[model samples]
Target: MEKVRQATDSTVEMPPATGRWKLIGPGIVAAATGVGAGDLVATLIAGSRFGYALLWAAVIGCIVKIALAEGSARYHLATGSTMLDGWRSLGRWTSWYFGTYIILWGFVYGATAMSATALPLAALFPILPLWAWAMISGLACALFVALNRYEMFENVMKFFIGLMFVIVAGVALLVGPNLGEAVQGLIPSIPEGSAIYTLGLIGGVGGTITMASYGYWVNAKGWRNPAWMGIMRLDNRVAYVVTGIFVIAMLIIGAELLYTAQIALSSGDRGLLDLDAVLEQRFGPFVSKLFLVGFFATSVSSILGVWHGVSLLFADFVRNHIKGETGISREGLETTPAFRFYLFWLTIPPMILLYFGRPFLLVIIYGALGAFFMPFLAITLIWLLNSSRVPAQWRSGWLSNGLLAIAALLFIVLCINEVIGLLG
Candidate 1:
């Protein structure tokens, strides 16, 4: 009954969204969750190393993410089921893989996200030590997410997205990017020694595990039927457009400011710190401080988005698998005990890794699982959307199939690259 075979008649008869513009919460949340501080660093490092030669890769990255988010949301809207419901229909193996992956992924990601958010704060305030700031940041975000409903969480994320747009994009303008060269960079050509960065920009722009949660967020926004399909697509595409702007802005700043000066930044979240120092030295203290605020906005939004969205995902998994609730899925995932428990899992347990370094075996497993998730999502989505699980009217067309296939191939390469690094 969870398969969408019976829903075709009602799905086809549903009316169009009255006003698509106003129906734009989940997409914004998805974008905020997807474009984190690490994503900015990867984009920045690419530009710093290769200037705008990889701009085409950044542009393509957004397009790929649009396909992914659209496919995920389409399944939800068409079937009126969560993504977990679709995956469950495939077999038991999907559950086994996701169960192992989400637990390990959350444990590792919790520490990484908290520390990322704390880095700029520690530099800005200098009152708390880094681990103290990380702990405080984790607890504060947990409390905030715990108290708020989806609407509050969404509004705050919107505010942070606005904050990021202004600061990061404003700084990009201040740096005076080379327009003519940027235009040239739009053509798809790889520079010497730029393969890894291009692959990262293509694969890691919007999200990893959080991509699977787009449907949960879509359901949370009350868009449960196929009538909402038009608005959902609009929301998904616009979200990635904003994501494109954020990454492209960072790339511009890197190319204009760091590339020409022959300055190389440290990799990972610390690279943004390096950019902060560069901003202060070149522009002044105020600009650098503003950039740090943007960095915090980026990190904090991602932390909260993951906390809220992925918790909904875990809650849905529990509802369908353990409880065996096969009736029409309720929009109650956010309120479930499983949701809060996962939130606690995300916020508390990982703080230990911040003080004591991540255990080697744990890191290896997490990295391997994290690397494989995108490919798994892409392949499984293609299968689900094309199979009888989704309604025929809303099944994968040529365009969706094409984009997802490309994503699968790209992600497979990235996963291999990740596993090799983890092992070797």
Candidate 2:
């Protein structure tokens, strides 16, 4: 009920990040978590369908996410509060929305992420069935997060991002991209009926709810004040730039390997598997296996990230709203009962979905609720950062405002389409 002032804490270290690249952690986590198998597959599909015609949209997508992630992280660094705290200050509606979302989304996504991650592992080693692999991988990821601290989790994510980079970039290069046509695509041309397709590429660039988790990761990494803002920006930018490049690489693969060859890939996580099979046929077993390894990294990264980050969010949500108790910092939410509970929620219960198909009603509800999360996050960030809830100097400038506004609009479009598809 009181407006807190001052952006920086005197006790926190304020060292310059001039030559300290290794000091960055949260951004890498955000990047790894954001660019999951779904994002990559979507990009690959775009490339396969339109070749390099939509390259500029992928680039712009990264820029949009950079703004959103940076805005979320900046709010934390500048105000010393989590996004949830800011959202709570807005209205009680924020609480209800997130409460429903984290529950349904986590339940459904647990099965989906496990299934996606398991697909490659199952393909690699046929000894186990997909459902068993899904449960094992999901539980294993939850265990790893529950056992380790953010420091260790971040290190593992770094490895995964690195693996993703090497594999996607390698495949892109191996396909020998056409520099000239790619340059032409940068000018932005509408390829007939590709409006919705192009929008999906832009909207699905990095991630959805994970962007809201950026601040928690920021706090988890000891960036609890505005002093860390400079390095945080640099870290956020570099991560999404790498994300952009990674998507671009996938696009190139789709263009050269799939588009030119007149190959079609399925949509969603299965699309990555389709790509892997295509790679095996076209490039050989080694290349296909390498892509599978990368696929494992991408999906696993998403699992670990959602397992940890969203748990922290749920913990905070429980702390302030459900429990009606406070005093726990956002950074400190990782150790809470609610945190571990959500982690378990993400791991075990979803295994049932892996066996019995998701209930049609449940799936529809999940889709309808999950669709608005990004729009909710973007709009809320815009509200919080532009209000007096943040320090005067640290509030969003016109450029930041513009980007957040654009992100909110774009996500709303995506939300509408998804909801109509689900309910219609």
Candidate 3:
């Protein structure tokens, strides 16, 4: 492999060309990161309430994410710059917004993610309390990320994803989904009073801030040039395909298990625990325990994914904005002060929230900030990829533009709904 100098003058080692199947790492990580326990719960709730009516929304959600992820990855390979770099190029305000958002979001998300991951662990082994397991989970994920690099992280995520796929999808199948109704779900129709849930399913499917991290993962995987575009596309496609399947499986469970029974689960991670009890009653302890283990895998994988991916974004922000670096380089990110600082920021400080509960004001702000991130991502990608900033050959085509526009509109509506909900 020869070193290729990007437009930013950063030297990236060009990885050897491999078959499409072999180029499927970052996407897997992205998929695993995006589909957490909350997503499953949301999908499950949608299925349980609306049956398969919103199944189209989940599939559309996957398609929208494919566009977002593809655009992010394409920008990195096209310009040899990170997404932060592109944002920086847009204006200083973008930098300011992201810097503030990352700090606040990570502070809150750290506690939430740790708690979610700890739920299944506590259920499986009730020796420890939830907060204790949360602290341990946080420490374990941070240590694993801090100790290893991209390859190990990706491999471990893949294993977790595979485990989740088998368990969740298997459970969905075991529930004996109504195939005819599920196929009907393919048509775009929203039952009355189902608007919010429909939008949520569409917008929330396998999406998170981790979608922005897709580019950083691409670079970490050593795919830094335009030549890897095809591979990136293939990788992105496979990621969402897997995501679609996982989400559909959850919908199946929700539809068959909960909807048919007219059982309503509570909101949040606790709902998953509630589901576990239901499973135990319906299918016995073994199947219920298997679902809990799968839940652990799903939740823990997100913790690890964010621990690694968002840390990279923070590292890039520091490198470009503070350290005066021109381009992103992988050498220092895993070991750099900024990287470790944010990693520590994500791990340690939030433990307080785990014990005492999140501050009300901070929760509000976090909610407002998070509500707008998807729209922010969608709008920015449209501006960056369609403009002269990206190379002419790599600029977004009509399909990309249309999909992104739809995503932006969808997220904007969702953001407004979020604000209204918060205010109400």
Each prediction's TM-score versus the true structure: 0.96, 0.97, 0.96
In model 3, which runs have C-alpha deviations exceeding 4 angstroms? 1-18, 328-330
Candidate 2: tens digits of C-alpha lDDT, residues 41-71: 8888888889999999998889899999999
Clash tally, candidates in order: 0, 0, 0
What stretches of model 2 exceed 4 Å from their correct place? 1-9, 326-328
Candidate 2 residue pairs that clash: none
lDDT tens digits, residue span 36-69, model 3 = 8898899999999999999999999999999999
C-alpha positional error of residue 334 in candidate 3 after TM-score superposition, expressed in Å: 1.3
Per-residue lDDT of candidate 1, residues 1-424 (tens digit): 3464333344334434376687687987897798888899888888988999999999998999999999999988887777888888888888899889988988999999999999999999999999999988889988888898888888999999999989999999999989999999999998889998899999988867788888888777767788778888989888889889888999999999889998998878999999999999999999999999999999999999999988888888888877767546456777789989999999899988998989999999999988989999999989988987777899999999999999999999999999999999
